[model samples]
Target: MVFEPDRLPVPAPVIMIVEPYGGSIRQQNPNLPMVFWDDAALTRGDGIFETLLIREGRICNLERHGARFKASAALLGLPEPILADWEKATHMALEAWFSHPHAGEASCTWTLSRGRASTGLASGWLVVQPISAEKIRQREQGVSVMTSSRGYTVEDYLPGIDVATGEAKGKIPKNPAPWMTVGAKTLAYAANMAALRYANANGFDDVIFTDGERVLEGATSTVVSFKGDKLRTPTPGGDILPGTTQAALFEYASAKGWRCKARELSLDHLYGADSVWLVSSVRIATRVTKLDGQKLPKPNNEKEIRALINKALG
Candidate 1:
């Protein structure tokens, strides 16, 4: 469905159902179903997923993205994802989607959904589609941003912390509601949508969430900045997804004789940085021009930073 830019109510596009659990797609394949989601994955958000760009039929950072996806599933007490011949499945999905007449030139995503099983974890599927290149272009020119106050700090439930007894005990917490899959790219994405809505209502393009006073990440991307010669991002301690683009920046920056580190970041530091940008699989790298009501100065080394990102993506 086509949505007008000035419409009051945003329209949810008709998501094409390429595959469904126990559906005809499964019967036809005879192998594993193309996509499957069990009751647990659908109802309880008990699975993990990943989205990556496909350029010229090649999935970007496939190995790294897959490793993170599997790790997140395990963290949520879900069954380990089957990796056998998964790369071939991902490529097939991308090729099919890109063949569409309206497919654009850049920015696509492959999503994997794990189905719920009666006794085990669940089944899974891979979905591939082209994303809007215009959206990426607009972000590249810089976008207005606001802060969301609805998410929790990753530190609240560190990997080793216990939630049942309200003590830092032996085991990790068991599926905390609301932010259960904060680190996982699960299908349950209401909070992220709410933050986006908040941004729209306030005449902003996007929102960055915080856990109390600590800056976590944007609803859809990783927060990155350049402070002098140092490239900094929030460490993937617990509260944020470990973005592959963010990881790539570290390697790229260091090779160019620049310092890169992951540490706890504060709002003031983000606001006061020499340059601030959001990185993700789609956008790759884009600057943040305004935060709240304040306009930030353009980075002195914008060209250098952009070069670093392009090199990394290649």
Candidate 2:
């Protein structure tokens, strides 16, 4: 395994603020500083979270992330997080980030988890920190992706349906599995992190997961592709997490004369695409210049894409 200390900065004295049980807000110095032997979020990963970009003073796509956060919480059987709670906590985190020595481009993460329900408390916290320059460089220079199997097919999440989009008809499947927790951005991300680590250990920058024969998503980002004036991503009906950045990019690109679609994708399709990308809130859209050690067909246009996305994203 490669240890790239420069690439991943070890956080020092993590500054964070919290609003426990949706009550009065409080701040914590250096790390969470909480004793949670019974916390479901930590032990069982029974929680929901959202990582959002704080551009200037605005939470990029607050409404979109808020909706997803609430939905995920509800699916996980945790207390729903209201938008106001997140907004209040986010501003507090921004305050902490600005005071930090390494602050620049900022990212905020809000986590709402199942706490001691008998005590009528649910654990929630919002922490803001610097967006790493190495992460930005991945977007600036592009990243390589390696495909990994999800073990579960798309049917485990969204059964019997193919294409989906935020604007598509019947986007959410009928009778989705409650235990599946598909499309919900929950704190149960160990598998996702493991996939990324596996890719990193093998020399790839990131991972693209596949369900059965179809490509699903990047470990922490949405897999996006462009072919013949079409911007395409795997449909949420395929149980892929609906990416806020990917959807926003599609909308932004649409205004710029690019047609966008959310549909079923296969590895073969990506291999034949003109260009590919892995998009997330902080990373925006990072070009996939190489996949599985083989250079992809398209020449990288990250500069042009980044400028357009940055303008649109900001």
Candidate 3:
């Protein structure tokens, strides 16, 4: 069976196209043709994007998303996004989306791509849609995850690092390779989506990618495990995209006197943790109830953990 993501019961999403040259925002019909066939974003996936949560007319965690957006652009060698312009487009899309009869949380994704080779200008746009019930359900009820090998080792990113022992062979190189696109949230997500499909085909809600020896991250979310008073996530660098939600949670948890750290995580850590969660911008926090068909132990203080995650999410 194919895994299909849940969709909102809407006719069409609100689309705000950002002009390639002057940075002007224009509303377009979702059913209409807007992007050109020759656009590199379509042809080569030569672009980057960020998905942000919109609650009560406000975009949650804009600063973190913006930082990651810029970082992805820098990694992809794309032009820096104009924050003011994107902010304006976000509001415009939100206004358009809310003008409809929709309710509940929504999301806005900003996409920037290299323009047609003939034109040399860039293309940018924003898409606003309501968050689906499936995501809400997963956030509330938790998920059953399957682990899949990412085929490459973390050592590819953090050179000389041992996946099993979590030991560095030597000082990691300052730069690995530009083509790696390790941390950038680029449009080239076919592999990631394929991983999700494989997991779904195997009767799993989501996938946690591992390098055959050590865990990496979720397909689209971050892998975070709580043991004792400490909150630990996979160390972010070339192996995976740095998680904005995880970073925010760590900051809030740290202020609340919870120990937070990033390190090379193993499957044993999750299987042995008090509780495991998959965190992302839209989903916020979703507990992992099972891994690879084995039931995980319940969290000792699930209620308190949920409360803290809700507070941190807000």
Clashes of each: 6, 0, 1
Model 3, global lDDT: 0.82
* Model 3 C-alpha lDDT per residue in residues 1-314, reported as the tens digit of each score: 67554543563688999864554688999889998989999999999899998876788889989888877777677888888788888888887787776444788899999988888888999898877788999988999999988865544444312321234444557775435545678898898899888888889999999886578889999999999999999887656667888888999999999999998999888888999999999988899999999999887799888888767767
Candidate 2 weakest ten by summed lDDT: 159-168
- Residue pairs in steric clash, candidate 2? none
User: Cα miss at 44, model 3 (Å)?
Assistant: 0.8
Model 2, TM vs. native? 0.85
lDDT by residue for model 1 (51-94), tens = 77766556776777877776666656555655544555555555
Estimate every model's Cα lDDT from 0 to 1. Answer: 0.65, 0.74, 0.82
Ranking by TM-score: 3, 2, 1
RMSD of each: 6.8, 4.6, 5.0
Q: Estimate each model's TM-score.
A: 0.76, 0.85, 0.89
Candidate 1 TM-score versus the reference: 0.76
